[model samples]
Target: MGVPLLAIVAWSGTGKTTLLQQVIPLLKARGIRTGLIKHTHHQMDIDTPGKDSYLLRKAGADQVIVASHQRWALMCETPDKPLDLADLAARMDYSALDLVLVEGFKDEPVAKIALWRRGVKGEVADLLDEHVIALVSDENLTIDLPLLDINQPVKIADFIENWLR
Candidate 1:
């Protein structure tokens, strides 16, 4: 692979976003480029109402893409068909990026760092099986993997560094 990819997974409210918010800047400080793919359970609109892109889509454009100096947005019309996460990942700028840290897609067959909190009542990381190669937790996990403290961003970065190497 041209660029390394990692999936950070956790149950709702397990602090996955909080963890990423810290880790991403830390990785960037180390001269590593990072791309993020976040999955949401609700409908999303990259283009807002009254915008030209949104208006085009309202007028029955299957896909409307608006590009600017800093960023670009694409709104595709798919009322019934959902695009797979892997396909979305492929569309990213992975060739020029160093790492793609994906959030969610717990059921997808991708390498993952599973996050868990003790007494919080959630499914085991083991439920993900072999795809989950490491654990970040606040409780003692019986699984045979490298366990790191939930707040230890450096250690977590070190694990990614070592694992990618």
Candidate 2:
């Protein structure tokens, strides 16, 4: 079976990362092996400057695999073309994970729980999208979808677990 994927989407500074930091451990405590994918618009480089891996990449290597006993990482340079959500997910090793929690890619047609704050202006209209299965917010919204408390990670994890099942 394909791994279940869910996106935790919100506007910047709306506590998406903070919620994940709490939710992941809670999920792990319940024996759910989770994978994560974080999307960013800013230019990012995982390889350190002047490092062998960095030098290799600078030398026109399209992909670099750095390995050691503890952990390994694959850094691919995509200068011209940006990959879509499916492409990114396909690259993840899903055999050991029960779920893949995706962060960002708000427009992707995937099941998601959107975090909304009262003062923060986000894509609130996204909550109406079919892909948004649930809404997590501080205020009590009267939407037709399932509403979750923003401060309670455990409860949110419960909702996610039930959804995964």
Candidate 3:
């Protein structure tokens, strides 16, 4: 199992999901199997009300897992509870994945690439205070870590691979 994981963190509206949408495919093209975990500040539900899975949860099940021939999903009924990222990682099939690209969890200890956009900001936030090993931005930054062009996914992927390896 060669599962290398990292977080792509940014403030709200920084295009974190868009960046992942671009990077994941490039990583896959390079033969990296990617997995992702996105942290949200609000309550979220993958299953809707009155659905079978939702009913199972409403009936007091702590967790409900649904599977098909092609894919599987689990909805855990813990709207107010926080999840442990490490435990979640451990539970995943890392044996088949090459990289786990987590989106958010800005305060987590995981190594991350801070995403920033210039020309449209107030004081830049301190992502470096977290475990940010690199910066991904559209303009020049004064951070101590290596900085990569936000549009260059291949270079970023190489940096990540080298850092993990």
Off by over 4 Å in 2: none
Per-candidate TM-score against the hidden true structure? 0.90, 0.95, 0.88
Q: Write the per-residue lDDT of candidate 3 for residues 32-106, one digit (tens) a residue.
A: 788898888876788888889888888899988988999889877665867888867776787878778889988
Candidate 2 lDDT, tens digit per residue, 3-119?
A: 888999998889999999999999999999999999988889998999999999999999999999998999988878866888888878888899999998888889999999988
Q: Which candidate is the best by lDDT?
A: 2
lDDT against the true structure, each candidate: 0.82, 0.90, 0.80
Clash pairs of candidate 1? none
lDDT, candidate 2, at 56: 94
lDDT digits (tens) for residues 1-165 of candidate 1: 456668998888888899999888888888778888898888788888897888888999998889999998666787888758767777787766888899988888888999988666677744456888899988776778888889899889888877877
Superposition error at 4 for model 1 (Å):
3.2
Q: Could you give me the TM-score of model 1 versus the true structure?
A: 0.90
User: Higher-TM-score candidate among 2 and 3?
Assistant: 2
Give the least accurate 10-residue stretch of model 1, judged by summed lDDT: 119-128
